[model samples]
Target chain A: MTANTPPKALAFDVFGTVVDWRTSIAALVGQVLSAVGRPDIDAFAFTDDWRMRYLIGMRDFGQTGRGFVKLDILHREMLDALLVDMQLDLAEADRHTLVMGWHRLEPWPDSVEGLNRLKRRFPLVTCSNGHIALLVNMARHAGLPWDAILGAEVAQAYKPAPAAYQRTAQALDIAPGELCLVAAHHGDLFAARAAGLQTAFIHRPLEYGGAPAPDLQFQQPWDYEAGSLTELAERMGC
Target chain B: MTANTPPKALAFDVFGTVVDWRTSIAALVGQVLSAVGRPDIDAFAFTDDWRMRYLIGMRDFGQTGRGFVKLDILHREMLDALLVDMQLDLAEADRHTLVMGWHRLEPWPDSVEGLNRLKRRFPLVTCSNGHIALLVNMARHAGLPWDAILGAEVAQAYKPAPAAYQRTAQALDIAPGELCLVAAHHGDLFAARAAGLQTAFIHRPLEYGGAPAPDLQFQQPWDYEAGSLTELAERMGC
Candidate 1:
């Protein structure tokens, strides 16, 4: 690409796209539930429940106009509810540690290498539902190099909401069309595209907590599609 | 520090600490004035003048109920005013490139390596007055590997305001005492310390446009004081 054709920036969806949130959360839930002698707790279901709460929290924040609530706070709130629903109670210390699972998500195999390659040419950022601290710690833990972290918390709105993508584009000083959202989830890509951001759909295939059904189907037209970040990086000529 | 000793995330004050704004702005001014056929214009004074307008912009944003404005937009406004005051006429394209100097700041000589070392152990983030886009572009251009970008822009409040530091600490899900503000400027460190954040003074004696000045001094007790981020990294056992 010519110099003027170079992308000004690349923003990522962190949870499943950059970091393997499902596997990470599943592993943590398995270890914890096993330790508590509740080995049959359906770790995947519990993980899904926790994430569902995060989504509900964002929707509530939007409806109530309570301003932005960081992911950590929302995670803690959701974790408490999840524990109650699961009929598990733990000490405050244990609860705090469990709530921190969001900070220790594992990166997908190609995330670091792909982001590093992309960063050689374009600024790379995270536009996740995760709060700033959680994303920062996750980067430190996973060794993912990000130029900056943007989130629904920054916009006081979450994905599927136009403001989330718009706020990120605004923060990057790029027109919505100039910056592309690289995500594994079709819903996220659709939302980003709807907000006028170009979209790159990378197939994660196993994002839905490893459910039997495949998760890698494109729902709409996106600017790019790749099998993985590695493919995306190669296609970007990085 | 023991593992139980909570990690103290290092939040940096970006503008003059990580970026050599004076040099960057001086160079931009020299280029703009030269292009306009006045090679001997006081670019240094012009830089300071433009910076004064930036400060006014911040104050106005803070005093009014207006949200935080991105540094680029604020800079453009101030740049226009500065050009009018200097009685210079310039093409919009040239003015655009000149304002983009903020995106091309040079990292201090020891910055990248120092930050790299710190990144090996501690989370390194930007706690800047610069807008998120400005900081992100500066980091990308200067090879500053920030784990995340935190700013008054996110909090809608400027530095020295308690909300700026507190919002950062909250975002990180770390207590104020568990986060440290590292900077060459005493005011930033003082504000951080006052807001209950640990402080670290990194001496950048030449931050103010290379003019001769009094020896840099530290007024408050910081958790650590070091000459550079490399030294700070070593101190933190990175």
Candidate 2:
């Protein structure tokens, strides 16, 4: 598909694509660490470690068909294990607050404005691994103006699993070909394309903080590509 | 609960509560009838009959735990059966246009404004039997800004079924008591209350055209009652 004829709907990958989760999580952790007199800890490294654990958990879930667990539960469990590994002591309330940092992440500079522009033309939804409540709270906090929330919890399966993409298209009553999966991650785009969805790649060069960026170039042919969501919206004439 | 202590979230029954389905369906059927040269048919009565069949279908589905079907498919099936009973002869494309009348229903005069006000105070969503796609399309068409769409499609069960209400609250990660099910129908409110949800009743006296309205009076003591959506929002200080 060309820019002139965009897909009927756009489903976004939320955590790193729409919201700058790494920066937000590091900031939140820094504040919490300072409050607990543990500011010596590297908050950015902690955030990256937490995210790596989440990916491992999702991979394990995908490997084993163990019944679906909501992302919040998984995050809390990961936080508990991480704190134990780091020999950190924190109150239950503080731990809960830190785990909920996912809900308060800040959006990318152009995410809200570009989403609003794209929404006027195509129905916009989140097809992330986040649970519905997490997605709803994030959208409310970031003013992301999504038409519907569809993701792992709604599909009872996480990303890279065919069920997640298939269920989202089914829920929208649209064929997979009519939907576009927009993400900053090549893996997500590749999986969505394999599921028969059109794919758009938005470059997020700083998604990993000081760490080396993933391949921002389109590894293979995709439906669309842009430097940012705002450009994507402009390309689609939104 | 008092007006000072509102529920964490408000879940609305969409069909007759938020949208004036009776008037909208009658208007659509009237247009279809004229197009088919069958203007003599009583559009209002036809709509009533169609709705009655929908109720019976829901009841049957609830009795037998047959796997979930999207509301659109059920509506189309019912339309086919109704057309046959009415001895209507219309092309398949025209029949489809008439069946899609559900998708184009107009909202009640106060729905958009009242929901906007209430949304400021609480996360508002729909808990009707309508599928996710149906609710999303209707909200976009009528300008009803829903934070999330949760209903039969997500729960895989129709309303009055315990799972539907339970799943919606669970999806929002709120206790049933922290969720208010607002509806114009007493039966819906009763079922929601039975499932441990707070209930709010908004009067929609003209929900049924010439047919007598369902008991407009609250069948039992509900958490809240109002003459209209605007009144409900005001009572809640939204």
Candidate 3:
């Protein structure tokens, strides 16, 4: 597929591509730590650690198809385990609030406008690993205009699984070739490409804070590549 | 549930309730008949007959639970059977266009504005028998502002099945009691209520044209009842 001929729909990876989960999580963790009288705790490290645990969880799910659980549940479970490891005492309400923070993650600066622009031409949907509730809440909170929510919850399978990409395209009633999976991660794009869907890579240099960034350079050929979602929209003639 | 306490999300019945499917289908069929040199065909009767076949298809699926097929496929099958019965000849492209008419159904006059208003307060989603793609396309065509698309495809079960309502509520991460199912059809509302969801009835007297309308009077107690979706929104204080 050529960049000149855009796909009918663009399915986005929400966590790092559309929403700045690292910064949002760190900010939320900072507030929680301060509220719990532990302002000295490194919120960024805590956020990174939590995210690492989530990655491990996804990896385990990919390796072992032991049924499916919503990402919100997994997030809460990981949060509880992290609290135990950190030896922090939090009230049930506070724990619930912190665990629900995933639902309140802020979108990247370019996300709302870029998506709105893209939406004028093509249907925009989230093809993330997040649960449907999480995607709905986050879109509502962040003012992201998604035509539909199609993701791990809708597919009953996590990302990197061919079913995820295939099911999303099926839900849209489009051939996999007519759907583009937009993400900042190469692994996601690679998997989407392998699933016979077009891929777009948007550079998110600050996705991991100061940690070594994923290779921003296009490791594999994709249908479209842009420095940011705004650039992506511009390239797509939105 | 009381009228004063609104649900977090409103799951709407799209076909006859939110969209004027009968009129839209008749109009499309009229165009197709004219194009095919069969303008003498009664488009309204054809529409009704096609709808009856669709209901029969749903009934068969409900009784069999053999698996699930998207409504688009079912509509195509029913259309083909009807064409055979009528001895009408149409080009493959015309047949495809006629089948695709389901995606172009017009919303009721109050649908767009009322949904937009309700959307400001509660997430508005479609819990229709239509597939996700059908709902998405219809929303886009008619400018219905749906937050997400959840339906028989998502649940892998047709409406009136407990699993449909239950799965929609589960997908929203809300208890069935906290998800309101708004429809003009009593059976759908009753099924939703049986599944523990709140119910709202909007009177759509013209849904079936000159054919006698379904008993408009609320046979059983419901959480909310209104003359139109606009009135429903007003009653809900949206």
Ranking by TM-score: 2, 3, 1
TM-score of every candidate relative to the true structure: 0.88, 0.96, 0.95
- At residue A156, give the lDDT of candidate 3: 86
What is the per-residue lDDT of model 3 for residues B151-212, given as tens digits with 9 covering 90 to 100?
78888888888999999999999999899999988878888989999999888878898576
- Which portions of model 1 show Cα errors greater than 4 Å? A1-7, A52-67, A209-218, B1-7, B52-66, B209-223
User: Which sequence of candidate numbers ranks them by DockQ, best first?
Assistant: 2, 1, 3
Interface root-mean-square deviation (Å) of every model: 1.0, 0.7, 0.8
Task: Output the worst ten-in-a-row residue range by lDDT, candidate 1 chain A.
Answer: A209-218
Evaluate residue A32 in candidate 2 and report its C-alpha lDDT on the 0 to 100 scale. 93
What's the true lDDT of residue B4 in model 2? 32
lDDT of 1 by residue, B77-181 (tens): 889999899898889998899888888899888899999998877888788888888787778788888887886888778887889999888777779888888
**For model 3 chain A, the run of ten residues with the poorest summed lDDT:** A210-219
lDDT per residue (tens digit) for residues A87-139 in model 2: 99889988888889899899999998999999888888889999998888988
Task: Please give the TM-score of chain B in predicted model 1.
Answer: 0.89
Clashing pairs in 1: none
Error of 2 at A235 (Å): 0.9
Error of 2 at A112 (Å): 0.8
